[model samples]
Target: MTAQATTSEPAASEPARRKTAIPKNPGRRDLGLRATLLFPNREIVERYYVPVIYTACRTCYSEQDPDEIFRRALAGDFDSLKMQKLIGSVIESGHGSTIEHVVFTFAISGVSRTLSHQLVRHRAGVAFDQQSQRYVKFKGAATMLPHSIAEGDPDLRTRYEEQVDGALGLYGDMLQAGVPGEDARFIFPNATRTNLVMTANLRALIHMSGLRLCTMAQWEIRRLFQLIRHEIFSVSPFLGSFLAPKCVPLGYCDEFNNRDGHCPIRPHKDRVLEAWAEKAAAARAAGRELPVT
Candidate 1:
């Protein structure tokens, strides 16, 4: 007979692990970051957006030509609800190209250089044109003051503000003393505000939003996505509804940073996998096979 291995749980006297601290919500701020949808206004989205995406989806399975499918979709020959259902099904099944047919253009402004550095990391199916520091000499450059610093010890906050102002002041001094704008910009801090015109396909937008909208993302970028979601909702709530943290669609959180389960929005994937393993082992001990999903 084969011997079975067993494991014991931690002793009752063992100290409980300390829970990770959850980040405090950053309250509303006048922070100038704004995301404005620059293309496909409501009329265009209502009239042709769905049909265009539906055409892309249906083209894969139907014998009909793609343009004919789009024409019928636009003419209301196909049921609107049914088209949405099909599109949703295709999206959930990981058929990303179906949604890539649609794209959004956004005028992003007043964001810090810090956020821009992170934002540009997303290079797939996206394009960005940023306000050039070398070409555009900023007469008045703004900076971001994070909520934590603004609301912390008063002296510390004052020092932080003064430091930022001094950097901008030095930048201006350099420019006035015949320094090239490009050379003067060397004094700009990461908090310096910048502008960008970003264009991304639906697939890439969703993927970027999934990472940026999560509770674990940097506060400033998370807020930016919140505004982006609002802009999308203004054009088409049906499409905007799809933008959410990646875990919302995956049914479990995969972020290694959330392994301690502090966020509480969803169970960590590691815990879920461990639970399944335990269940399978118990089933085997009973001489029965556990079913896999």
Candidate 2:
């Protein structure tokens, strides 16, 4: 009698709950990003971007001929930081051509198709050759599902699988219907990923890295830059050195979002200017000269 009463308590009052149809985390997922020098190699950079920037620097201070300056820079005589400071100012001042003479090529692979789509949108100063979807038939096409959907509330996870699976099925049907591979690929979602190799000069790489490495950049593409930075570091820490968050070399952050002066990679430009003004006022009060850069 006790067992029967205990089991009968309150079935009607218990809220109905949906059952989970799937489980999560069968295994680790890979970002699968990779980067390596695809062209110009180590020899080319050790010979070029350095000497190129060096010449750009020395041309300002030297009485010697520009060609003569290039010869010594290529041969190595002056400190790199002095050259870098001048180059930095030139870049900041929008004289970008001085850094354009050198280029870096990267083999970028296994990034999401979603990222590659946004990445190829860069209209100027970069080149890319992506793995073709048009010519390649899907013997077994692969796809990426984000961790959120991968390890998600069960009903949501089921919906995501159904969507991806349904997409693949439609793609196969389209091909079977004699649709062109390109047209059929319209059914392919961003989760259907790809690889590419890209080449860009130092100026462009710096420009792209600044925007892409920022916290504003989409996470997958940011991861790609992290790998790219690692690859460049492997080749030449000296030159690979320049490809970084713009804040790193600027000594002050310029990000609009950082206007509150958070991220301490550098003082925000606003804060820096405020500090300068305060210093100038203090100097005037003390009847002393304020040094200027």
Q: Highest TM-score among the candidates is held by which one?
A: 1
lDDT of 2 by residue, 1-293 (tens): 00000112337878865433212211223455567778777777667767777787667777988888888777777666676677767777777777777777888876678989988988668899999999987755667566666556979877777887788888899999999998998888787767788988778888888877765577677767777777777766866677888777677878887787555567789999999999999999999979876
TM-score for model 2? Answer: 0.74
Q: Model 1's lDDT to the true fold?
A: 0.87
lDDT of 1 by residue, 1-293 (tens): 10111223457999975554545333344566789999979999989999999999999999999999999998999999999999899999999998888899999998889999999999999999999999988888878877667667989978887888888889889999999999999989898889999999999999999999888999888889889988999999999988999999999999999999988878999999999899999999999989867
The lDDT of each candidate is 0.87, 0.73
Error of 1 at 199 (Å): 0.7
- Clashing residue pairs, backbone N/CA/C < 3 A, model 2: none
Instruction: For residue 192, give model 1's deviation from the true position in Å.
Output: 0.7
